[model samples]
Target: MGTLPVAKKKKAGRQKCSSKPVKLPDDASAEELARLARAVAHPARVRILRLLTDRETCICGEIVAELPLAQSTVSQHLKILKESGMIQGEI
Candidate 1:
């Protein structure tokens, strides 16, 4: 009888990854970084930021249409972003 071929075994250990350390500007303060973190803390906020980044300008109605949230909910998110200096709007 012919013997079955043995399968190759994969190494059982954590793979080593080489990465460069990120460098921040000297003027960037911890408070500023924390504020920025707070700005995109929510999933909806992150999505909103991504949408805004894709276009030079977008209206509130357009943002509302893209998200699953209601108009009011989107408005609140926009308010947070605006207050955090992550976005700007006209009166």
Candidate 2:
């Protein structure tokens, strides 16, 4: 009878998917797309943006009044949107 071939031992480590770094667009608009998407990731943020768009002017209190969320929560969502460059605050 012929002897069976022995199987080689497998290495126990996470395999790398790719060694090369992924290339992303250098344009401001391309970068902004991701930021804007993240900013509106929450339902509250989407609602806030929609409300703002419908009005000529708005305030934090106004936004809170329109939504079911608490003032602080609304403010937090607004802050995220602002920081992501999706909204502007008036003085």
Candidate 3:
């Protein structure tokens, strides 16, 4: 009997995300503004934004190294920022 190929299982926990900026329709800006505001609402997110602004680019590991939070925490923050179009990267 031929063995069936097992489908690869996705790892649990924070999944990888692309930080590429997502463009929205012109009319969508107002709706997105609130989300963007919330994304930067946290101090940690603010610091992350500043770090990216100062450096112009950063890897997820680099951001995590600079912050006191755990890697998972940083990843979550990055995800929010990326989703809001505040920052872009592969994380």
Candidate 4:
């Protein structure tokens, strides 16, 4: 009998977006800053946004195909961008 490899489960814990929706310095809400930080945290995400910003339109699936990352990872990155108001999802 052949052995099958086991798949690891991913972590899906809750994260607090901000302490409160209080006014921020420079009119940048804490949430917005956090979101921007998340977007710029990863090099891949930077690349992803750069591609989308320069292209007429970018398909999420195409990004996964272009980058040497797992499809799910790329999707996560896309989700971050969408949440950050930096990009939109077409499908």
Candidate 5:
């Protein structure tokens, strides 16, 4: 019997968004736009936002399950989202 080779998991590095920034209307404050931009700067956070919007609610464990991240990492992402006013919840 041939043995299957196990693939090594690569360590995740910081990812940068390659898309150009959209010009917002003059009414929006630069600080507000920066805050919101920081909130979604990570792919994981974006995924979490999508997951929450899809169901209206979710626990930290649920979000962790959907992403390939650790519980602590997910919690950190959630914290950034909350601080940026992107999301709100006890978890």
Candidate 6:
């Protein structure tokens, strides 16, 4: 079966996200805001975070069982969320 390829990021210009809830500090960089917004943009990533947030822990293999995506793909997604500080794990 062919896996649905992840969409390439759109190279739109640095459009100001006026809808941002809280105004960021002056010291925050554009790249930092963009990265944070991107991390919470996916449904799968949101689900993973929600699961961990409630349970307080989960292994990579368990996530794979709950998601349609492959284990490696789920791990990659988890890594991104973890790196972005939206989630944490035992390991």
TM-score against native, each model: 0.66, 0.63, 0.64, 0.60, 0.67, 0.58
Off by over 4 Å in 5: 1-27
Tell me the lDDT of model 4 at 90. Answer: 25
Candidate 3 Cα misplacement greater than 4 A, ranges:
1-28
lDDT of model 1 at position 41: 96
Measured with C-alpha atoms, the lDDT of residue 36 in candidate 3 is 71
Q: Cα deviation in Å at residue 50, candidate 3?
A: 0.5
Clashes of 2: 0
lDDT of 2 by residue, 1-91 (tens): 1111111122332111111122234665866687767987999988876676565445566667899998878767866866765554421
In candidate 5, the residue pairs with backbone N, CA or C atoms under 3 Å apart (3 or more residues apart, or in different chains) clash, namely none
Cα error, candidate 4, residue 32 (Å): 2.0
Which window of 10 residues has the lowest lDDT sum in candidate 4? 1-10
RMSD of 4: 14.9
Candidate 5 weakest ten by summed lDDT: 1-10
Model 6 lDDT-worst window of ten: 13-22
Work out how many backbone clashes candidate 1 has: 0
- Over the stretch 1-91, how does candidate 4's per-residue lDDT look in tens digits? 1111111122332111111122225878788788678777999988875555455434455567778998779778766755665554222
For this target, which candidate reaches the highest TM-score against the unseen true structure? Answer: 5
Better of 2 and 4 by TM-score: 2
Q: What does candidate 5's lDDT look like per residue over 1-91, in tens digits?
A: 1111111122342221111223345787989899889989999888876676565234566667789999889878877876765654333
* Candidate 3 residue lDDT tens string, 18-86: 233345556776777788779979999888766665552345666678999999899788778767666
Q: How far is candidate 6 from the true structure (C-alpha RMSD, Å)?
A: 14.7
What lDDT score is found at residue 66 in candidate 4? 78
- By lDDT rank, best first, the candidates go 3, 5, 1, 2, 4, 6
RMSD of each: 20.6, 23.4, 12.0, 14.9, 15.5, 14.7
> Who wins the lDDT comparison?
3
